[model samples]
Target: MRYRPVAFGLAVAALAAVSLTTPAQAKPAASSTTMANTTSAGTTATRVVTAAIPFGQNGDIPVARNYSGDSRYEIAVFRPSNGTWYIRGVGAYKFGQNGDIPVPADFTGDGRAELALFRPSNGYWYVRGVGQFTWGQAGDVPVPANYIGDSRAEAAVFRPSTGKWWIRGTAAIAWGRSGDIPVPADYLGDSHADLGVFRPATAQWWVRGAATIAWGVNGDIPVPANWVGTAKADLAIFRPSTGAWNLRGTSPVTWGTNGDRPQPGNYAGDTGTDQVVWRPSNGTWYLRYRVPITPPPPPPPNCDPSYPTVCIPPPPPDLNCGDITYRNFKVIGTDPHHFDSDHDGIGCES
Candidate 1:
């Protein structure tokens, strides 16, 4: 997954990580308090405040955000069961910089996605399973997808400055022209995700998969999901000010309000992605589902009896003091000791 950078002034940097453990326990059903509003058209819109990223195979959505007003970063997994969303496996990374985007992918083909970030301060990309790599290009937006035919996803980015797409998977490919705001999906229906970009100035989407054509107008953000139930990804755009969504093969509908972030995912394992929005103002997530999703079976208890009072901690960040080599580990915690050594604000350089 990829994200647009947020503009904000920075303070001094620090790195820290927190680990927790807990005892085994039965999972609770997922439930949420929903507020429903009837539109003029008589359609009832249900809004649930859930702060999470897109859902993965395990019904877990990994969310990352800057820790308060400090340089630390926090990442956690949100699991939806029964009718409630549970936040678990929380971890923190110490060396997050302003304008950094946390991108999670299964770079090692481990069946689990690892969290990474694009640190603007060093002009490099960092992946938990794959360490730091030089992405000296300008407009380095972290765009993760399966550009290769492999089943695993890769750490990729679209460089608007050069209109090029770069993927660091089993192999590296740099192609395409200058493009803005990448919208990756299975555009070709080939099972492998393809790359697309939306030019906000012209409100057009340039897709490069089954066919290359420009579509849409006056779009601000790209919302990709399996709207047609064809198992292939489709495109949509959200007009933030108006809270209207223009789906390529569907009529326009209003779902969110201003200041809501688009986060589309297949939260129910239905193979169909659902539209989601995260409003930072209240840290709530709103989801709109086209089809009813059957909740997944609960996972087995993983609590450690010996450490009943200890909280289960998520994986640690991949950091090597003085070694610039890219190590595969999730980025979390603060670097108060300057473990990022060179003081470039990026912890493990090599």
Candidate 2:
């Protein structure tokens, strides 16, 4: 979200609102996917696709495919909805759509949409949808590395419009390749390549590109990076709305050798963005990347018994609870009244 103030003849104006709308569809319920157990907080987590998605040529239509043997895919599930998606029939040399792209059982979103494929033989993997016949590699395209003739790249496409997802590519430290995408040549490139989309509870253009994006509760975007097989790689989610990326957490994978690449997919986890689900090459699911986590610092040690009142920082002088004496000036009484105004147990103006 980029905002700037403009000074006019006698007023200050904030430019806002670009109109773009999709034709109304029957309720999102009209074209919902069958979900077995979809209830939340005692209520039903109904599927809702409120916007018009230009998914290739099909728009809101759904399609299916099949696969063969000795082949594997990297699939990522949509958070909570409990859906799974993967890339099938991708050859090391080119892209083919003949294989099955299974839509997870619980996946009930607006058109069942997966990601575009990136086949090294063809140079790169382009994004394509159902309605459209050709892939749209013009603006955003992901180009990963090729290790030992086998492509070592992974990708997961969440609700792209959510603006909380990012792509990461890991190559051998020696594997150096720049991911190139088309940019406006004449624009002078004032913007950075860090781009993403987002969806807010009540805001327009939350789905931003090359801009700050944030997510709900555990909302986060995936980032692609090159990491070593032996060491762990730290990753931070980018917040486009604030132009800040934070080290919300880290991920470490036992990477393959120079020729081995990490397979990417959406892992099933607790139905929120706060949880991370990564599927390992063995097809087992993990809650986090294998790495040491730094536990939070221990709370300041209990005040020393001999010196009860020790000022911290502005550095309170050490005062002994046993030796510190208090004299009441404001209150006069036959009975002694101390500084413990609230009177919990301590007898001084603590």
**Whole-model Cα lDDT per candidate?**
0.53, 0.25
Compose the digit string of candidate 1's lDDT tens values, residues 1-350.
24333223222122233322323322323345343433334544343323333222243344532222122222343322221112233443333344565565566665555555566666666654345665545457777777776876666767766777777634444444564678888877887887777776676666774455455556468777666457677777777988888778667877788877666665434444555666655445566654333456998665323223322222244323433333322233444324445545443444
Q: What are the C-alpha RMSDs, in order, of all predicted structures?
A: 26.0, 21.7
Global Cα lDDT for candidate 2: 0.25
Stretches of candidate 1 above 4 Å error? 1-95, 169-179, 212-214, 290-350
Enumerate clash totals for all models, in the order shown. 44, 35
lDDT of 2 by residue, 1-350 (tens): 11122111112111133121222322322224322322344433332122111211111112111122122222232111111122222211111232213222111123233333432333233323221122112232332222122222223222222212223332212111122111111011222122222223321112122322232223323333211121122233333333233432343222222211122222211232211222222322222222222356998765333223531111144333345454221322221223335544444443
TM-score of each: 0.56, 0.22
**Candidate 2 RMSD to the real structure:** 21.7
